[model samples]
Target: MTEQQDIQLTFEEIVCACDNNIDWVVSVIEEEIISVHGKPQQASYSGFQLSRIRRAHRISRDFEASVPATALILQLLDELETLRKGG
Candidate 1:
């Protein structure tokens, strides 16, 4: 993958990119619904992670799913995409 596609972003950047609030992001982090790659005090995430954050936030908000439930749904979606790609 290109560096652009794999670019890393700080938590705040992810929030703006995903249009999600910091509290929600922190909540997901605490729930382990997604992850970051830095110290706990300054966690950073990849561009792809921003995509997942967007999807998870939207899914949870629109469908009233809990963080764990949303994570499960996203996992299933990822599996579906992987299967479609024969990966």
Candidate 2:
């Protein structure tokens, strides 16, 4: 099987991708909904993480969900996907 490389995005790029402010990204990081590499101010995220960020932002915006709630929702979704993959 061929291997695929995950794209990494900087803090600023992540914020731009979500079209939100830095505070939002920081809050997600603080909540541990997503993780990063490198220094705090210079953190970088994988493309997979970027998908999580976008999902969390949409869930929060569309349902007015709290960060913690969004985190739980994302976890459940992750589990479901894993099951679908028979893992």
Candidate 3:
């Protein structure tokens, strides 16, 4: 059987996947919405981190949410998801 490897994405790929710019990505990073594995230019993220970015991006774009607001929203959503999962 083949083992599955986690996909690691670069900073640019995350920005592209979220259809956002570097500044916006930086904003989310500053707000601690997601964590990176290296320096900004060479930053790397897991697929799960990318999901968080997408969710934050959507909230920011759709709700005109401030970085802090987006962070809080993500936290609440994560907690809700955990509860739903009976975790």
lDDT of each: 0.76, 0.84, 0.86
Q: State, as a TM-score between 0 and 1, how close model 3 is to the true structure.
A: 0.85
Cα error, residue 53 of model 1, in Å, equals 0.4
TM-score of each: 0.72, 0.81, 0.85
TM-score ranking, best first: 3, 2, 1
For model 1, the local distance difference test gives 0.76
Q: Write the per-residue lDDT of candidate 3 for residues 4-86, one digit (tens) a residue.
A: 88898888899897675888888888888997655765877888888889989999989999889999998999899999999
RMSD of 2: 1.9
Error of 1 at 45 (Å): 2.1
Worst 10 residues of 2 by lDDT: 35-44
Best by TM-score: 3
